[model samples]
Target: MPDAPTGVSRALREAPPDRVVEAADRAIRSVLGASGTVVFVADYRINGLWPVLDSRQPDAAAHALQGPLQRCFSSQQPVRAAATDGSCQLYLPLSVWGERLGVLMVEMPEEPPESVVRRATDIAGEVALALHAADRETDRYRRARRQERLSMAAELQWELLPGRSVSHGSFQLAGQLEPAYTVGGDHFDWSLDDGRLTVTVLNGDGIGLTAALLTAVTVNAMRNARRSGGGLVEQAELASDTVYYQHRGHRHVATVLLELDCATGRAQAVDAGSPHLLRLRGSTVSRVPLEQQLPLGMFAETRYALQEFDLDPGDRLFVVSDGVWGADPSGRETYGERAMARAMRATRLQPPPEAVGTVMRELQAFHADADLRDDAVVVCLDWQGPDGRAD
Candidate 1:
């Protein structure tokens, strides 16, 4: 047998973002005088920016990100406003491997002599290089952790999954879980019995070990409920109750349940504050809106709602977690539902599994080799012609 696949590797997981910011601050203080300095990362697409760390003027530092900083980062050039005025305000682009990471801004009370200015430029270069190295280190950590967690989570998730992708001939289904790291909160399961296919997909809040734990609890709860021989609605209710009682006040689990009928092609879904599920049919891509509610273990006041839809011959269903929606080319904005719709349309011609892969690949491209901030997951189910053929 082939070895298990790792999710996000440990090497890519780098140190926490907070630590990276702190290191950047220390570098600034050591290189430049103690007047005041700040460091911010530029958006990947070079559109807008945001402050990752700021020592002197925190609020102002963030505000400064929105200005013409993009031009400096894009051109990999430095600006010296009041540079010639004797006062000191220097803006330098943080470039690494010919790509801009962000910028470093320094404002000293007195203009340093010529020697100091030259040294400052050199300092900026070193700082930029450091930041780049840090980012790469973080990526390595993420990849290693992802791979490890993915191997474990995939094993657990697969064992809990319905034996085959397209089972019992009534409906066709296949799902894959991709984490920004070794483990993910996103998952799916399906079982066919007595002509009904029970499909489920969930996105537990956060990622890493915590999300994985909650997911384990959730799937176990479902399994126990399933063995109780309860109907779909009853099983879901019992499972929710079990989760609530089991992890009361834990506030980090979100799940969606769907029951499909082989004969009628009808699907009944119960959504508890997860992302939207899409149904595709050639030109028309239908958006299945899930009623918003608190995640599991949040409130006794929260309730799960069940919605139903009929599947056509060529209809397709797709579900995803935050990682997919968070894929933004500009990095400043999220790739919202609209973008997901367009992506689906663009890849409509591909096979079900290939289409899903296409989305993941595109998202990786948008992030520009950057590790995801959270777990990413996507599952596609198609109900067209020959059920589970490997075509």
Candidate 2:
């Protein structure tokens, strides 16, 4: 008889990226004689969790996913709890490279041996790696986390955005856009080049597909320029010129293209009608002054200039869109500068991912009962300066 599938190698060999979770579930269930297995991955927005391969017909899996599963995510660790009065299960967090991806739930007839539980954790880690690898193309995974249906434009925009966060020893970056289900005209992109990390955030005015198309054109224009060996100012000009020539000053994008030297903390920024940045140091939060230039697509001859700044280790920079600060969609009538300041002060010490979520939650509550009138975005990075430290 053929040997039964086992371990990370066996599981990965048997499943495609789109079906990796289901493949993992079978592996764990076989080893533990577990009655069932379910994989819960983080939603696209990173705001909550959702289940994968919960095949129970009556929707029982949804009810089963609560309790210890939630604890696994909140605590960022593996958990063991009774699945029912007489049965026990284990929940393990799915993570890779310090990013918390989601949770794994294994329901067994009884508590398994310690050795078996340890192996399960190992499997969960492998599963996270697989999920991350397959995220971009897996409709099952993406559909599970989506809070609502996305418009065609929002779907394209979402596809262009990175996976919520990325980090290195010298710095950690996390970003989010609100009204999680539908978003348009707000996007951010990042890349590392020659020991420097480049980040660009854009906000296109107006609404619907037009704004999204403009953002797509602008970001791609910037990308093409950067690929051709241009710096921040040149990238800004290329995007601006592309928009101006294509739309004839009819549309524009507010942008901030920034490059940070992870080795030296030397920072350069080019602003095109974007909001002033916020800096948090120790326990103080303040707005750093930055000159604004004409937005992209506005004029044929507009030029953008580079602005320089310094980021000491432990300083955090907050880049946001006006929608984030505009407020009063249906809640507070204005998130206002004071409200934003208070939120920043409250979350100054949290890690980037946690801090981003906390800020989004507060904004959602503040905009209670109202549709997100505009795309709201927030991107943050903590500079660790040279020597490569993370806090």
RMSD of each: 17.1, 3.6
Residue 300, model 1, lDDT: 49
Each model's lDDT comes to 0.59, 0.78
For candidate 2, give the lDDT: 0.78
Expressed as tens digits, the lDDT of each residue in 160-247 for candidate 2 is: 8756777787888888876666788988898877788999999987777788888999989999999899999889998999999998
Off by over 4 Å in 2: 1-6, 30-36, 54-67, 82-88, 97-100, 107-119, 329-333, 387-391
lDDT of 1 by residue, 255-363 (tens): 7788877766788877766756887787677777657655655654345666777877667788877668766655566764466777777766654544665666666
TM-score of each: 0.56, 0.87
Q: Where does the lowest 10-residue lDDT sum fall in candidate 1?
A: 1-10
